[model samples]
Target: MELLQLQYFLVVARLEHVTEAARSLHVTQSSLSKTIGRLEEDLGVPLFDRVGRKLRLNEYGNKFLHRAERALFELEQGKQELRDLSSPEQGTLELAVTAASALPHILREFRKKRPHVQFHVQMLATQEMVKLLHQGDVDVCLSSPAVEEEDIECQVVYNDPILVAVPKGHRLAERTSVSLTELKDESFIGVKRGYGTRDLADRICKSVGFEPKYVYEGDEPARLSALVEAEIGIAFIPSTARNSRDQIQYLQVENHELVREIALLWHKRRYISQTALEFREVVADYFKPLT
Candidate 1:
């Protein structure tokens, strides 16, 4: 019934190991177990099914977990509201981002405007960012291929063209633009499937009646320029990520509107603090010139 009990239960439910949960919670294993037992007694039902050292969340636990998360989120929001009322400009913004290339500029501008404000940023894939937003774990997100879910306010802040990057002397390098069909047989370098850019490229390539022949698949989009410079493979990179200093040639995708819509996303029902609002404004203004 206590808030602490719910907190402990949620951690245990997530980890599914009493010892691991206790260690993470920084509490004794016996104390954590006792608290969970008390919570089950109060609820008149067991939340987890015991199997050796691993504790699996039962059907009851699954149902209760959502309610527990909502209750805790509301309580935390109330506390944050009180804190914001005292000093509206000085607090942390919980932000998630899939559009990593645009973050440095946005954050630099944001810091200049609100030096007292702090940021806790998570670099996540598109689906991961969307999940965190729905869970209320992140106050806001800057993502690509804008989320289309209901109850989430997603606005396109920038439309960055996707370009094909090649080594300086490659056959396609001299060309101003190349079609996906032209590069159907060429080796490609790409990020992993979960990434928004990679997914977008796959969809676009498929539409053009070809699948990209990826010679190298990596998690870091930042490495694309370097990889292309090394002649490892050509890659589909966003315009914002292109650097003139890199020894690579960027080509436009001919006859295709291959642009990624960089978006700002937030849950419509979640509490929005003054700091979050200011950060949102900062993002909106940062992309104004680019738009």
Candidate 2:
């Protein structure tokens, strides 16, 4: 019923632990419980199902949470709009990306255009980026394996070529291009399963009639090049990731659609300020000539 109650409820629902949520909100556990209880009473239904010390959102809570989140998001947007009115040239743009290879170039371009504007950036997994965008936690997202949600607006920023990376002296290192089928039996170093690059590589490998056998599965895309250089495994490396590393050779994948389309995404319903719009333009322009 109260704004404070709604805020407390949202934290509890997200964490699913009363103690942790209370600690995060810097409130006493008993007080948080009382607030949630009052909210449930006001609504005439329990928002959560209790199982020992843990909590889970019930059907009614699930339905209400979406609306609750939207209400808070809109209110926060209104507050941001007011703040922007006072300081139009300076504001923090919250951004999320799946990879960091192309980020620096885009950010440098953006900063040149809007030196007064600041950025708060997070490198997240593809799925986590989607969740943050939907929750209105981040202003914009640069993602791969682009999202297809109904309320999300996704635009292709660039189609980065994915190549096979091999050690300097490997048999295929002398080649300019190689097919996925040729590397079918070779061990690979790959990004984790949920990653966009990994998904694309897996799909391509499967199309070639085999799944990539990864000897090293890592979270960092930058490290894959080193892993390949050590003869640990070959890997599918994006063109943006080829940051002047001399120990490895990058070969184009022959007769295959070995490209990852990086997309810029944002929620359609979330408010966009001038600062955010400028950054978006900077991003689009950064990739324009390359495409």
Candidate 3:
């Protein structure tokens, strides 16, 4: 069978859940199921037995697991061993993130140190990152903290204290920060549903005992910033979004210690490559993101 087929087989075996495995792998469940079926046909034996909707590894499957794991381990070891010979800095790091602020310095330093290594970065939602780690589609992810799911292990990379972005002319800009009570009647630009930012925005508003006036909503970070510059409403973004903009200013909320913690996540069961670990160190040092 192909390497991909074996990898998929192992993922399915670990999860014993086709749907979750497929979602994590960033592939359709039907496709993965077919791949496993083809693999079983080639081997003339089934690795899984479906009991209603659940899957269990049969005796034959358990017997094959040791061999399969050995093979996978050897394959990875081969790649790791040959890393030095492949190129100057060798090996590839595939990482995905949800925003732009946390990228620049880390990327520059990574490329500078490992010019031969390659990078693949994707901006994704917090849940998407956790799913990909489970399926092995990506090795690492950074996003907002997800508490409800115990399946995904996450560590805080940076605690992003939520900052208020308002146009300079606004009355609130005179203060260091605003509070939920202070901004109860103030116009607000809302983050759209289904996005990771939306949850934080909603929670902050709810704490004030009032729904925010929705000036606008979208996936674009720039659009929301523009609305704030136009003074249509105030927007809340991570402190990192604070940049040199004359028309716009960032302020802290009064007595509001609300922090939108950005986290680095991975499947606790998986082993991270040395190269990936190096990258994590650089990122951790890059922002030195405030706690």
For 1-291, candidate 1 gives per-residue lDDT tens digits of 999999999999999999999999999999999999999999999999999879999999999999999899889879878988998768889999888887889899999989998789988888888898988889999998798988799989999999999998899888889988999899999888888889999998999999999999987789888889999999999999998855788899989889999999999988888988999999999899888
The candidate with the higher lDDT, 2 or 3, is 2
Distance (Å) between predicted and true CA of 24, model 3? 17
Report the Cα lDDT for residue 33, model 2: 92
Q: In candidate 3, where is summed lDDT lowest over 10 consecutive residues? A: 80-89
How many clashes (backbone N, Cα, C below 3 Å) per candidate? 0, 0, 3
lDDT of 3 by residue, 1-291 (tens): 889988998988899998888988999988998999998999899899997546789997898888998789778757655663565357778787765566776789988877877779877666676677766678777666543455566767777777888899899777776677777788878556655566777776787687777768776665777788888898887777677778887878776667777767766655677677778777777757454
**Each prediction's whole-model lDDT (CA):** 0.91, 0.88, 0.75
lDDT of 2 at 188: 90
* Model 1 TM-score, all chains together: 0.86
RMSD of 3: 5.9
Which candidate, 2 or 3, has the higher TM-score? 2
